[model samples]
Target: MPKKHLPDPEKYELGEPYTHLGIPFPRLPATFEKNSVPLKEDYKMRSMDYLDTPEAYSLFEKQADLIIENGWKGIIDVGCRHGPVVDILMDKGYTDFNYMGFDTSAQPIEYAQETWQEFDNIEYRVMSWNEFAPAGASKGHKQLGQNNKKETDEEWWSRAGVKFKVDFHVDVMIWSGVLLYEPTYHLWFFHNMHNAYGAQNAIIQEPLKDQRAECWREDLELNTIEHRLHMYKTKYYEYESWEFDLDIFSGRRIISRVKLWQDGDSKWEDWVDTHGQLAANPHTEILPSGYKVIPYIFRGKLNFELSQRDQTLCQVALEKMFKERHSHRLADNYSRDKLHLGKMYMYNFVFDGDEPVFCSGVQNVTDKVVRVFSRYFAFEKYKTDGTTLLEKNDNFEELQYAMHWIRDRIIFWSRDKSPKFFERLKVKNELFSEWTVHPTKINIIYPNNEQYIFYTPKVPAEWWKNGNYDGFFK
Candidate 1:
């Protein structure tokens, strides 16, 4: 007799594929709206409305055409939860294209497969996006996907699934509105893109200016910035100073400073001209037609893989990553006989100590990895299973110490609070630890989660009270 723990191998346990066979398609709830669809008020059916939304339609059109035109063989919508977007596309008579939708949610995938069984070209996988962090980030986690109950919301997808491994080079990867709902995964999503097709092209539809206005308003409204600028403009005195006013962050001044450049009348014109492209002209008339010069860092391929060395390096890097991270461990219990060798696996990087560490998970494993990493790194958990032990750990002293370190190093980059200061840190090479430091402009062009760009730099005029990077030819 087989051991109780191992379970009888030859006993022929009723597996999911057989038991779940002939399971009827999910019916729209009774409370559903017209056309046999779930009600808009129902939170569970939130993914459906994206089909009717104008923005979603337009994005779909653009991506579909872009992918076809760009010679991309297919497209993958990362975090494609319910495949509603694809359904919409099919309804619109958009076919003859290659596509795959992945979600960590199994019932949804099963429902999708059952609902759209006619589409021979489409495929689905239940895996979290966190599986695609950098090489060293995976920290060998656990597995998931033991149970397979379609009716139960707490099935495999609801549970954390397997870890993912990423391969770059998708022609036109599109994410409709998934990122907004999962804000904390912003970095994780970008990290996956950067790793997968670091050199390939991508088009992400995200809210770029959504927070910029508020961020700017807070920067302009600070009294310290006002007073400091006034002092430098009038007195032309040099001093390093900071002021704090309670009642900001529950009686704490959250924003420390906003560094602005103040120049004398003669040099002011020169400064304005230098940054002309970034500013808007007050007068529409052709009175010099000045525009402010806005500095933006972008990531793109420096050159096509024209050079043999570049191609070789790309292959080598990908091979090393494939050999190290891809085990199809994430796809365990899913019939290895049918598994394809060309299948891409993406894994998340959980830093043991600020290093890119690796971890694996079966169906529900990625979710656990996400939770642990977020808690340990103080990163907000995006789409994962449970809370981390680190969060519940009652070691107040240790937590406080960690927060203090994070405050000085990480929190300082809170652009929401202090854009100017954060920008300063990004451009300037301030030593954080022996391992990590501020990245230069070049590094910003090829950014990863560990990398970020300086949206705004604090250029306190006090620093140039006399003159520095200010006067022309001086």
Candidate 2:
């Protein structure tokens, strides 16, 4: 897939936050001297152009909906660039949320603080995950400190004037497009968020590269034994090429419910035993601090019943299709269990006799979009020697049928404008693409420097028409 074209960052001058095509976008400060914090080498400054993209707005709206649906009062957005998430949430009438935006880059956080100073409930902090040390190592030892005075969690929040009514627990932790660069501390960060901070859930979006062991054969051999062991320990699951890695950005987003265990906890031993089986070598050695990091699992996709009466046949056909198209080695992983955690969905096409003729598996990405993985036909051609031969290209019709079914039923927003299976579906006019207006409203803008109108399908009209979107204020 070709990468989506974005405005050049060099074209914009560094100054105060200004309107670009009528959208209020934060400007990158000329220097970081004011904050006395140098930018990290891995911190790549992003342009406000991303706000205009469909993916960005869709994710923002969806997350805000999730926050509201779960009744989560406090949210900590990690790597919040210029506080776009906060801005969107506030615009959606969530002013009561206890929102804290944190980022390693000082300039963005500084800009966010200045931009959102009017909101008493919102706070922006220039801090890295590595530097964050929560008050308590365990639930029993919870404590907070201020002005050289040690206080309990409640006393600290009360004295500090934080608006949260409950105990100091972050309901949700968001890491949007920031975890890929910090791969080394990804698991540790998740661990800390669940155990130290009071994050019950997390929304993590990262660039999904092909990090499978087979693909990293050469890289694995070149790395030190210790590094290889660590890689195997963490990323043990084998991923098929078609399972993910679809677009130019190659993004994989996951919303997970965090589960944590301490040494004394009843579930701690069970978790350790599971890890031992998954790890390279099982050993009796345990951490002296009793801090254990468990792997995160994505919430499963919502299951919708199909009209096909013979469900077992459909399952069998899907398994055969997986073996043929995807890796034969990882065929078992493509089964029911793998369907959870953003794996794949099997759509069966049954003909007149209630016979399953074709099946295609697609990955349901955040209920926003779907990516087709494998399309297969159940038919086999007989050769001159009376041997059966399975041809690949015979499933185009079935593929088209499945794609249309997904587009009409499951997908609210489509990444592909000109999909192979579907005709040209009209998106929003370019003039209305600016982020200044509410996602539901149609607002257009024309910048002075640009020749063509700047617009995007941030929120697809079809979604609203089909009653698919139930976001904030709706």
Candidate 3:
């Protein structure tokens, strides 16, 4: 018999894939009016009625595309002004799918209710995500996905018509252009959505903050971004992200991740890619036109083999990363099935301005080994001719480099030594052959300079057959 200690849903399960009654994305109605919508102060476009235009409709289509691609059912879109995404989804003529959307704007709520009321299992409310704030932050200490059907009205946010009458269950929840507006209740809503409302996955889109200008910095100060980078590092085993722009100044990014616990019992141990380091993320770059041409930290998925396309992007980035950082060793010919080049994962990249100054993620993993790369590209000195200072050096062996892991803790770099740091690590878009063994005892640095040393337990020599080499990380 199977063990009884595993986790599962008592009142909810993963929502079934929505079955469509007709062809996908039939023509939607053009009843959405745009001419005289009230514009908010300091705004350039129509408020809430932006969906009436073809340009803005395309944006909603993109967001809706991400939702459908995730195979989500029973969606709850936070800050869903006018429910443009709902209209896009319903145009597909899918049946048995449920949608629940909420926004603070009363006009948009009324508009959505009047328009989408024709569809069954659809709801809209003039409510904010902050209405369901349970006290305290859930830093993984709270038991999650508990939509306890018996909670009181206050517990369920059922105070009259200003809140949810009962707990809602969904496989996925989403928010676009909502994260930049909430200053305090941002993370709390994300936490409560899973812990109280039973949303297992999330797709979040927000403007990338650029602090070079005071106006941008002040705008960012009005919002909260706490615990985001850390959350991305530790929460999901695999996640997906992409970047897009509506216009030039828009550095919008979308990320979707499944809860780690949903991957089953034993697999939870392997979910977190622990070697990520948060480096300097230059949120903006002043362009020649005096406007920012922000590089999307998201162009494609840099996940750990999320897809073949993702793998190619990350592999190319990795090869270039070794060259950029001047790192040498990455296990010469370590092409074992379990710990091969395909497993080399891309975590996140930090841009200093236009150039990526830091890259962090797992280098590769094995049952006995896990190597995470924390390549700090900023530490290398640059010349006036736009090349790294290390480029001019003739004798590579004579030079020395240090990784400042902490305030005082430092690691030395040498090609002959274990845990090589900077040693001409790449050749022709591939790893060099001079690299031999994976460091048995080596340090993995985080973006914050937190240090962790990963090593395997010592074993007797000559344990495996000749050329079997199954013990070392290599």
Give the candidate number with the greatest TM-score: 3
- Across 1-474, the per-residue lDDT of candidate 3 in tens digits comes to 211121122221222221113211112222324332122312211332323444346566766776677667767788777667766876664444577887777665665576665555788877655445433323354422233234453444333223553233366667766765544445655654554444556767654544223212121232324236356447654456564543222223344444534543222212222111111111223333232222122212223213354344435545555554433234332222322334433234333343433343334334434343322232233223445533422112111110111111111222223333332343321222333334444333223222223222212223323362333333
- Which scores greater on lDDT, model 2 or model 3? 3
Model 2 lDDT per residue over 259-369, tens place: 233232322222211121111111111122221111111112322222243444445545555555344344554555653434444333333243333343544544343
Order by TM-score, highest first: 3, 2, 1
Evaluation by lDDT, superior candidate among 1 and 2? 2
Name every residue pair that clashes in candidate 2: 430-454, 430-455, 433-455, 433-456
Q: What's model 3's lDDT at 300?
A: 22
TM-scores of the models, in the given order?
Answer: 0.28, 0.34, 0.39
Give the CA lDDT, 0 to 100, for residue 83 in model 1: 61
Candidate number with the higher lDDT (1 or 3): 3
Give the C-alpha miss distance for residue 154 in model 3, angstroms.
6.5
Residue range with the least summed lDDT across 10 consecutive positions in model 2: 277-286
Candidate 2 whole-model C-alpha lDDT, 0 to 1: 0.40
Clashes found in each candidate (C-alpha, N, C closer than 3 A):
44, 4, 4
Shift in Å, residue 420, candidate 1 = 62
Report how far off residue 280 is in candidate 1 (Å).
48
What is the C-alpha local distance difference test score of each model?
0.31, 0.40, 0.41
